[model samples]
Target: MNLKATLEQWRMFKAVVEAGGFNQAAEQVHKSQSSIHHAVQKLESALGLTLFFNEGRRVTLTEAGELMYRRACYLLDEAHKVESVANSLKSGVETYLRIAVDIIFPPEMLYKALNKVSQDYPLLRIELMETVLNGANTLLKEGEVDLGISPFPLNSGFSEDLCEIDFIAVAHPSHPLHALNRVLTLEDLKGHRQIVVRDSSTERKAESGWLGADQRWTVSHVRTSIDIIRQGLGFAWLPLAIIRNELETGVLKPLPLEQGGLRKALLFLCFADGDRLGPAARAFLGELRYQTMSLPSVESIAE
Candidate 1:
């Protein structure tokens, strides 16, 4: 028996299985109904198996047909990936991209953007570094990263205002601050310990959002500060994105400050050189920008 199977034959079989009939499959594959039917016949003949059973004009897959269909789907997917990788390489997409993101930025937003890039450029390598405050800026200045998302603008790079992150002063529900029962003032917070995240930069060590509380505990990362606050160790102003679940579950409660419990930090996305960015870096930036636009604007929420 002579056996010959082609990619086109497998594609026709898949389309027929998915579209429910040869006529519909022909419409999808841009082939005539007879051609689609003939391709499946040849495919079944090549494998020496009955792939489908016909009942009048309707058709259904046999057990062997279902198995072949599953294998054909895998083969087609792998073929598409091979073509995609070839095109990416020909287009000069970078093999490796390093991005420094501010720790205060929402993790979900970052992951969503990175996930999209991975789908488009599967061959690209990504290095993600989470930094605090000016740490991203430092990385960009040192030429250690291709892109940087910082809360503050860098001195020598192309930058754009990405989005504003809302920070809320919060404490554990069982903390003494919540027991005050009234709108607490700055003076009232001075006696309690404040959990502050130290700036990650080795040179500057800049600090922000300190309320001059007499007692303080400094931590390196925002996550650490949040964990400490959740334990009722101290109160800290944290990004609302990181603590939404805690706020909903009554684990953490926003402190009612006289001035306002929330503050907005403007974030910027900077490139070492916009003109020099490779295709992978540019595509990643585009995805990041698109996802940032979907986030809630500062005006949408009460200050």
Candidate 2:
């Protein structure tokens, strides 16, 4: 079969269908209108069917055209995937890194760490998938992502505790709870409206299954939740790393919780038989550990 010819015709037909006319398709595909017309004509002849109903200035797909469009789209997408894989193999470029990340590392920290690693390993490339918890476990186990940074308890057997972020409840100084220095009991917060960022995963167990869940308002991200806390909307549990600036500036104050402090365990994960992290991912993770103060000794959460 003339595969190249079939592909060329498919391209022309798709361009015409998407661009709404032969002339427009020519402009988009950088071919002459006559060339596009000829290609589509050849395609129809080869398929033994009329693809479109010709009406002046408007072209509508025939029944066959509709069916072919669906199939053609899948074919092109598969072709592109094959091409991408071929190029990666030929050039020896690492094409994708499926990663799971805790929302704990805000954008700035994540970028800085990645930047440092990219410096030494220029050929290394990445496609990162970020999630708050174990959402990316399936991809990691299936070897889709090279590694994932998630919180414990991890779904995969091959995992290591990479970081720890102490959780601190904070509120504005003028808020009534501020005078208490640190109200270390749950009862202290019962009377005041609380703000929380909800996480359904096991890592978010701190806030999960709370009978007091209704007393607090929920926000989607830490930054926004902290912003509301600054405005004195309510007190919230936040990572100490994230609130350091606010604490120093007196924009926010940590409340005394019942426990000495709330802490969370962060884990780095890979498939049980996965290869060691490439230079880039490894370098980035090393920097991440340093920046987040997660280094020195890696510890497991108490059983």
Candidate 3:
């Protein structure tokens, strides 16, 4: 059978539906209207069906044409999938990598890496999705994400530990909680306001993490929560890496809690144990591992 002719007629049919007329489709597809008409006529003849009901200049698809149009879309979609697979094979790399991560890594880091890698490996592509511990792990289990950077322990047995980060709480310079040289207690934080990250689905929400917490406000992003705290709005819990400068400049002061600061490990997750990392992913992970180790410890909270 002449598959090429059938495919050409299928595409022309789609074009005509999209353009709303044969003349417009001809202009868009760079084909004469007569050529398009001839192809469709041949297609109908070969298939033993009526495709169009011609009335003067306006053309409408017959019942058979409408049914064929639907199937044609699926056929074209499959063709594009084939093309994508061929390109991926020719490029000698995987087609896609979907990574879901905790909101820890800033977009700047990923954007910078993309810019650098795209120069050398044009086919390399990375997509970033943000989720908390539960959501991130779910995507990894469902095979939605090629990887996930999570804080949750991987019971799925398909993950590896990336690195651990210390969580620290900080208060504004003028807040009452900062005036106490003694370690901050729940009672000490009771009267004061606090800014906290409220994990939610639709929007990043903020609420007090401490109840016996406080009357403080909540914010979604660490940057904004830290900003408000620096302005003396309230105290907040955040990674020390995010607030290093403010600590040094005396804009924000540590709460001096007697208990050790919260310690959370950042983990890398994949679908199977001993999964081999891709080259681009490996490079990024190498730099991240080095950077994570070099981070200043909580001892620098006084700085």
Candidate 4:
């Protein structure tokens, strides 16, 4: 089984589509325009299908080329991942580890786990993606991060019960809602502003619960939402871990909702490529599991 086209040729073909034309693609790949053209031509000949057509002063994908371009993109991405795996293997104990941890996962716990892992690999470089909602899962699916701690249940990949986060509806003690001095209903919040956090996933944006209120304020970070609520600007359901200080200090008070005052989500440890677990990734995983050994989980939430 001899493949006529090479990964280099496919990369140049993808470059042309992404860069908008061969001239730009040439500049991007740091190669001559003729070389870029030759590579695309070779790819077309090998595949026996025209991938692009020259129109007036612009180059565009042919009907068949559109499909091939998509296929080529997948091929190139997988090839890049293969190289990444190889690099990890060649250099034992990966020098860099990309991690995505949902903000709800207790920042203090996360920092402790990271510190524990760093003790063994002092030179490890870590890229921490503090995501909200579906953000961690998005990065894992896109191969952007090696591992993640997410609240969303995984559709694929290896996952284990990490911990449970309690979300409570709270507002500033001075807010108008507390003036009622009685149990509140969903309808009671209709006229008040609800501070909501934006889902971090650009690929698959989703909503968890919508409290149909007259006013809504969407913020990117939980800290921002909490800050707003602390000022009596609005009310929000914030993670107990993050707002514990505020709640204890009486800066934020719980809203007496009719029911479901406490919302609990079980977070999971996610591994993008669990099959090829690198030493650095495995170390982080172990540290996380070790730290969460006594934390509350689904069973505790039920009780």
Candidate 5:
């Protein structure tokens, strides 16, 4: 069967939709606007479908466009996966590895794993992105990261239960909420401010943690949220992995809640395409698992 449209045309079409217009798509993909326009026109002609209607400078997808867009995305993803699989089989150790890790994952463990793996492959490059919430999952799905440590229910890829992060509601000892000197409730928390870490994903919908308080501040990192909390401005449910020192030093104190003071997020080790994993990616995964095996949880890390 002969197909009228090429993957490049679909790629161009997808890029135009994502970038909002042909001109933007041109800039994004490093192609001229004329070429993008021609490709999209050709795609619509071949399929006999109207994919976009243009505003002054923007393009909006028609209903049929939306349907084709989704199918095109899937097609493009599968095409990339096939190329990756072929490359893995023919190539030696990958020269570089990209990993996306949820911020809640222990930094020490990551550093140790990378260091251990790098010892054997001195020239291997690593790109480590510290993401929040769905960020790692999105990166893995988009094939941006070869590996990831992210919360489960991923849209794509293979995942295994890895570890859990213990989050506790905490605030500065000087904050008025602590002055009550009793088990705190959500009602009590409502009067105060809460700091939350922003999700790093670009396209898909993402959530900042619990918006429990009337006043809220959103930041890009957990450390930023912790820093604001330490300043007596707000309170938040923070992961214990990074806040242990602050807890011991009295820089922060846990909310005395009757119930629901703590929460847990189970993270998983995800592969971008597990069966087609390159040699370096495989080695890195093995080293990461080996390093994580010794520490069961944050409680065990302290021991």
Candidate 6:
């Protein structure tokens, strides 16, 4: 039994179980409240237990300090991602990247691949994050982003495809389904009011391209379901490159759906490994695959 626990006594027992004691974990680890109570009393006397209990001045953790504060927060987040990939390979790049995207992925090809990675990595630091459907695969499965375009195709990392995205089903040129729009159907959009959007996945909640209308309305951005269907307050399905100027000037119209109002999607591009990416996430994923090969596909949005 020679353990001698340390990562500075599991970072002073996770800063006194997240600063609830030892004088606010010695003012949050700046040390000395008698060195964070002698490093959590030498990590509970080298793990013989009794992690925390005193309630008078508050400090509660105890079931072996909630399993050693969830394994010392996964060993201090894998030792801060091994000191952030050894300071991004000794500062050759990636001082920050993040990404995430997917708000129908095509804001002018993500502003021309972030204006050519800010004129070739002008000191990295990107971040971005938009998100919507599967919300960029829930921020790349919660590593909280480091590249993820997404539309679907993720089942565990390194995807690619990257493009497609059409959708249409609009409305609002004086709504009332554009005055009995000639092609409209699904029982004339089951009594109007659809909008939708939502699904930013906290863990589940998804509903894509809804038709279950019974006066729907959800909305959580796709530019707030195209500004609440441009104020006519309904009919949604957007992203024809974000309603190409509300379908060119008429301020939105397209509901001629005798079957389904367009649709396409695709998109991909995820990450999580591309050889442990860096150098500004491999130069903004080679300018997001050379500006997603000059977009406009899905048979040019079905003509």
Please report the candidate that would top lDDT against the real structure: 1
For candidate 1, write residues 189-297 as lDDT tens digits. Answer: 9999998887877668866588899998888889899899999999989888777777778888889999857898999999756655778788888999898876654
Off by over 4 Å in 5: 1-79, 294-303
What would the TM-scores of all predictions be?
0.68, 0.57, 0.58, 0.82, 0.74, 0.42
Off-target runs (Cα >4 Å) in candidate 3 are 1-91, 105-120, 200-212, 260-278, 300-303
Q: Please write out the lDDT profile of model 4 over residues 115-180, one tens digit for every residue.
A: 988998899999999998889998988878889888876787788888878888899999999999
Ranking according to TM-score, highest score first: 4, 5, 1, 3, 2, 6
- Which prediction has more favorable lDDT, 3 or 4? 4
Candidate 4 regions with alpha-carbon error over 4 angstroms: 137-144, 153-161, 202-210, 245-251, 266-268, 275-277, 296-303
Candidate 3 C-alpha RMSD relative to the actual structure: 8.8
Candidate 1 lDDT trough over 10 residues, lowest sum: 294-303
Pairs clashing within candidate 2: 98-145, 182-256, 184-257, 184-258
lDDT of 3 by residue, 182-221 (tens): 7777667768777766553333232324454648675656
**lDDT: worst 10-residue window of model 3:** 200-209
Score candidate 2 by TM-score against the native.
Answer: 0.57
Candidate 1 TM-score, true structure as reference: 0.68
The CA lDDT at 174 in model 4 is 96
TM-score of 6: 0.42
Q: All candidates' lDDT scores?
A: 0.86, 0.67, 0.67, 0.84, 0.85, 0.79
Q: Which of the numbered candidates is closest to the native, going by highest TM-score?
A: 4
Better of 1 and 4 by lDDT: 1
RMSD of 1: 16.9
